[model samples]
Target: SNLETETEKLIQIVLIGQPELDQLLKKNELRQLRQRITISWELLPLNRDETRGYIQHRINVALGKGRVQFSRSAVELIYKYSHGIPRMINVLADRSLLIAYTMNTKKITPKIVRPAVKDVGGLNPLTTWIDSLWKTILPGFLALSILLFGANYLMLPDFNKKNVEEKDLNLIIKENPIIPKNLIISNSQAPIIDLPQSGNLALEKMKPVTPSHQAYTPDDSLTTKLLNPRRIPSTKPLIIS
Candidate 1:
């Protein structure tokens, strides 16, 4: 400010800060500095029309004029969620583009923008109101419903404890009668040692107990030798004494 005053207001120094900067500048210690601030402008959020234009301008610059398109509803939703903030608008727009690209669509609609807004961490006015309403009313509604149900249940007459009528076993069996189908029976070529009475017995009888050569032993000499196991004299003669 002094430098600007010395130079006859030729030099300009701009001070930029958040919304709270105004409160900070109004403090007693900074009164002189605040007074010297000739031009004081609060950066206000863009209105609906300006927001739409800003989004369109960004789209045109990033992806040529006609390459991508945002639907009217999508733009409105973006404006509502972003509250006309350019940074948030950019974030939401980028996410919407990504969602549309993933879905293989060129046009962005509200359906595409809604999830983007949620992911970008902002809810439009209507959505915020609805969410709050649910939070406020749902528990009360549920409690009322439960109370009504309980009252209705208590007002009802006592139920009879008598046993229910037994169904007719014969009628039920007859209604759902089991009908046997014609079963195919195959014959075996091998000679039968005994007639099998059951499926398991038939399977066991069909299995070969021994090989044909082993089953047809001419004599029991091998069996006798294995059973006796007698020791024979050695053929060497030097230790005969």
Candidate 2:
């Protein structure tokens, strides 16, 4: 009667376990009481696109619905550094926010994200390894490349011609590689005038010309000059009485 009642009121039970537990169960060292059941769903890490939302969610929680912005570059860097793990994202985000706050910054820039990721522990080992590759290995690699290039350059055979005699060398030293197109050669053209020789040859533009003085005195007879020039005869009005 109890078995019949249990069958009539059967409740669906779900179990969640990791791959190691499954392996143990298969080895018979560990066993599920109900035996074989279906594996329905597999959860995977959040992807890069999802990680942005995840970070925003955590940041929203932290800010109590206030507005604090994350630069797009900062978000991309966080995604790359965290590899889309929620826990690592949380750690990096928290550290980054703390860093930004301590630095009195309002937005999370890429510069802030990089330092925060480096400082945060529990980040994926691969991410840390890649970061280290950039920090330590890259400079060394660049130096090695430069060294190799220099060595290759040095090893090549010298193709230089033999040095000329002293007289020839002197002549070569005095000789200009480029001939002046406008040399003052004796010709029909007038001989160039001797320019005023000085360390500072004053350019035509540099000479300062004195400005013309303007007489701007106000005339006392301004009103009469405009209309009626009321002039008095200078010779006592020619008193011919």
Question: TM-score of predicted model 2?
Answer: 0.40
Across residues 118-231, which tens digit of lDDT does each residue of candidate 1 receive?
Answer: 887646553557888899899899999999999988998656454223557678766886743233224323332432335434445554467866874434674454445454
lDDT per residue as tens, model 2, 64-93: 345678888888888877777676677788
TM-score for each model: 0.44, 0.40
Which regions of candidate 2 deviate over 4 angstroms?
Answer: 1-28, 33-40, 61-63, 122-241
**Counting only residues 3 or more apart in sequence or on different chains, how many pairs clash (N, Cα, C under 3 Å) in candidate 2?**
0
Clashing pairs in 1: none
Worst 10-residue lDDT window for candidate 1 reads 183-192
The local distance difference test score of model 1 is 0.75
Global Cα RMSD, each model: 25.0, 24.1
